[model samples]
Target chain A: MTIKILGTGCPKCKQTVDIVNKAVAKLGADIKVEKVEDIIKIMEYNVISTPVVVVDESVKIKGRVPTMSEITALIQAS
Target chain B: MFDWLIYFSDWLIYDVSGLSEGSRLGTALSFFVYDVIKILILLFLISFIMGIVNVYFPVEKLRNYLNSRKLYGLEYLFSAIFGAITPFCSCSSVPLFIGFVQGGIPLGVTFSFLITSPLVNEIALALFLGMFGWKVTLIYAITGILLGTFGGFILGKLDLKDWLTDWVKDIMAKTYEKGDTVTADSINFIKELPLISREAWHIVKGVLLYIIIGIGIGAAMHGYVPENFFEQYLGGGQWWTVPAAVIIAVPMYANAAAIVPVIQVLVVKGVPLGTAIAFMMSTVGLSLPEATLLKKVMTFKLISVFFLVVTVFIVASGYLFNLVL
Candidate 1:
């Protein structure tokens, strides 16, 4: 499974990265967490806000950082 | 409404601390205490209420609404109002700006949103109401809206589409694609309280330092500066001071929360209300970091034009306020 974090390098995006990594580590998941920072690439996702979490190609969250529990739940569900 | 707070501050400083009522230290500390408590309460209340409102009426819906409507130029007003309500961080502006442009919103309308989003917001509103009286707050809010409306209208007429950077132009030329929309979950106010509270607390924590430092400087000025110190230099009669204040403020970026308290003290020190407000607006509205971010989307010429137009309006409003108020 793959998780893509879309942002333009904002502080919140960095926080989102940290939280997602920790959540993945805790859950012992084999998910590949990738960061999408290019503006054009981010726009391709059609998101106006940053720090979006895309599980596979579907956007799970956008515009805010999700909690660890939320991330773990999302990973397990996906 | 805050008489109890005033009374409590007086008692704490004069009775409990045993400081003389009129002493400089006593006056400054009291001012600090009253202002800090009052502003914090107001901030939390406003943030909580606004958070609830934002959740119910998502900004994405508003953006789509603005894009789909042709409001006979009243869209500028609506866009400015939208800007005032949405609470995106400054760094996220570029993406939002591109989104608006891609969504077929007029350049001017988008400009209106960009101009007012940072300048007039709930936090600024609460700060203004807490520090200054409602009358000043009302006037300031109206002026900010008007500034965005007029500033955007003028920019829209400039036909500066080519002023956008090549990368933006390339993106604009591409066929627009609509992203998947997140459907709002059913209303559950009971479950939403925690989220609302977290948002409110987040806002308060974000500006806590600014509030302290701003009020700290204000308290010092209140205690030590002579009543006429600022007035003597930046008096209402000085035509140059208004423009000078705006110019000086353009490069120095500070949020409204930090600047408002200092502005209140400046007014108390006898600086013209108009001049002080102009400085506050310019400082909050125009900044080097925001400009650098915009470079990703707009050419240097367009950015300069945007700044010049806004600066002129701020200076004009400053003069108008001096004449009327």
Candidate 2:
């Protein structure tokens, strides 16, 4: 499974990556987490805001930064 | 509440420190403790409320609508309001600026969003409320919005398409217009509570240091920095102070978060409210980095014009505030 974090590497976007990565580690899953910074690529997912999280090709969250608990839960279900 | 705080300060200074309450050390300590507790609490509440409010604005949907439509009179107003919620800085704002232009939104509306988003920010509001109270904060916000709206309206009216870089102008010609109806997901506030709290917490943490430093500086200046540090500009109602403040701030640029404390210190150290506000608006509105980023899309002529217009507006706002407040 793959997780995509969308943002142009703002401070909050960086925090989102760290949270998602830590969640993946705790689950002991070999899932790959990627940073999708390109605006066109992000818009392709129909996302309007930065720091969006995409799990397995489905749009999950956007705009606001998610906490560790929220990230772990979103990823675990995926 | 203030009485309680006053009593607490007196007790701490007289009973704990054995220092006379009239001493400078006593006053500084009291001011420091009272301000820190009060401001931090205010910051927490305001952030929480703003977080709750932010959930209602479907920004992507709003942007999608702005991109697709050709709003004439209302465009500037909507764009200015939307700018308040956009989560972007100068660098990150570039991609979105490109997207807006490519989507066929007018250059002026885009400029409105770009200008007000950073100028009248939540962080700035929170800090200002913590330090200067709501009345001054309200005036600052109103001026910021007006600047965005009015500046954008005039710029858009000029229709300076030729001033934009060739690539941006080319993108403006592209016809990838989406439909008008924006089917945003129905929002549920209860479900968003967790995110709201987390967002508020992050905001509180982000500016915790600024508040500490701001209050620290205010505390130090409370009894230290000579009361008449700015005396030369006071007695005669220094009419030139506002413009002078803007000139000083233009070269030494900083964001609201970093400079707000400095602004607080300036006000505490005898600078007029109008002068302080003018300096702040200059910092936010005409920063060198923002100008550089805008230069990507704007010509030298338009860029220089934008700065010139915004500076005049800021200086005017300062003088107006001095006259009224």
Q: RMSD per prediction, one decimal? A: 2.1, 3.4
**Candidate 2 structure quality by residue, lDDT tens digits, B1-325:** 3568767867877789898867878877877777666666666776677666667755556677776677767888889888875544555566567767666677888878877877887677767886788898998888888888988888778778888777666656767555223225677878888777778778778777766776776666655677657655552467777888898788655435656766787776677788888888787677888777667778899888778777888888888877887
Q: Write the per-residue lDDT of candidate 1 for residues B260-295, one digit (tens) a residue.
A: 898888888888989877887888788788898899
TM-score for chain B of all predictions: 0.94, 0.84
Kindly provide the TM-score of model 2 when superposed on the true structure, using C-alpha atoms. 0.84
The lDDT of each candidate is 0.85, 0.74
Q: Candidate 1 clashing pairs?
A: none
Q: Model 2 misses residue B259 by how many Å?
A: 3.4
Candidate 1, TM-score vs. the true structure?
Answer: 0.93
CA deviation > 4 Å runs, candidate 2: A38-48, A56-58, B1-20, B64-72, B85-92, B177-183, B233-240, B250-255, B292-302
Question: What are the models' TM-scores?
Answer: 0.93, 0.84
Off by over 4 Å in 1: B10-23
Top TM-score: which candidate number? Answer: 1
